[model samples]
Target: LNFQLLRVMEEWQQQLGEQHYVAMANDLLMNLDLPGQVSSLTDIGPELLVQLFEAICCDCRVGMIRPAVTQADLRHNLACVIDSLANDVLHVSLSHIRPADLMSGNYEAIRNLLEIFHGLMEFLVGRSAGGDGGDVTAETQLEENENLNGRLTDQLDRIAGQAAEINELAKRLAELRQADRPLPQTPLPATAAAAAVDAEAAPNGDTSDEGIVQ
Candidate 1:
């Protein structure tokens, strides 16, 4: 998938020039499409979504995006991805009757969802730290700018907070799964007495250890 993205990027840079190519990339990142395909992260499934995000981040970092893709676009796309994932997490979390069941339910899919958000956040923070738009001026007046920025900030903050809430719930559920799971009687990597100990420990005959075991 990344190889294909690279090839497309090369072709785009050659034909459309760096500026337009950057704009195109921004559209893909924002709208989650690639040329003729509807290749959004949600559309790609869990396995490929992370790879696609990695490719997008790489493009943002060193793909020579200039004169078209602005820092604002980068930030906007990151925010969009974050917001989208947050909504997904909230939906799944809210819809489920038992949050702990998430481990046996849609756990893998939910984890993948969070992973994408984390990846985007890492890229966004890294790009922001590079002073990508440091020279860009905020020409708005203080009062009006503060009002507008405050509203935008509030929206992003709400999304981020929702994502964080989902993340915390996921973590708690995962830990619940782990804690409820029976511990191995024999530890892995046997010591000098390896010949005597069985690597596969017997499952606990005690059922109480399993809490809401699915």
Candidate 2:
């Protein structure tokens, strides 16, 4: 971390405050693909990246995004931010942020955030789907997201595997058909020996093998 980024982050921390991190996180989360999410308000510097992340999460937390916001709905949003940072945000290129890096950074904090989202999401899913189980509501979001994400992931894998199998079977069928069909047969021409024998045996034929000899 450079002094420039440090100063920028400090400024953001002061300006946005920790209470508003969720909203900040939310905005940054949505605008990963946009060019001027927060770099417009905050000065452009090395910590520019950190500033953006903080602005996103924190801004979304307490700022203007509340009415339509939910802490439990942020993984995909976070993933989107992470993807933008790793991929490039708003046409602003980032060196290379591995998704694993996001996973490892502040796992506890991230987990806590995810847990909040998970609970919130579960509530929404159940409420929307009309499922009932009062005790299951606490960590319902995490359980649901994990299960659904896993099932969808598995379904994709199965579909890919099936396509490969069908392709292989089609290739084999073509080969078997080529091998099973009978090959063309060429007829042998009549031999000279049979003609000679028939001439020799004729009642008026030349004696011995002289006639056939020529």
Q: Which candidate is the best by lDDT?
A: 2
TM-score of 1: 0.26
Assess each prediction's global lDDT (C-alpha) against the native: 0.39, 0.41
| Index of the highest-TM-score prediction | 1
List all candidate RMSDs to the true structure.
Answer: 20.1, 23.5
TM-score (C-alpha) between model 2 and the true structure: 0.24
**lDDT against true structure, model 1:** 0.39
lDDT of 2 by residue, 150-189 (tens): 5434534543464465455555555645566432232332
* Weakest ten-residue segment in model 2 by summed lDDT: 39-48
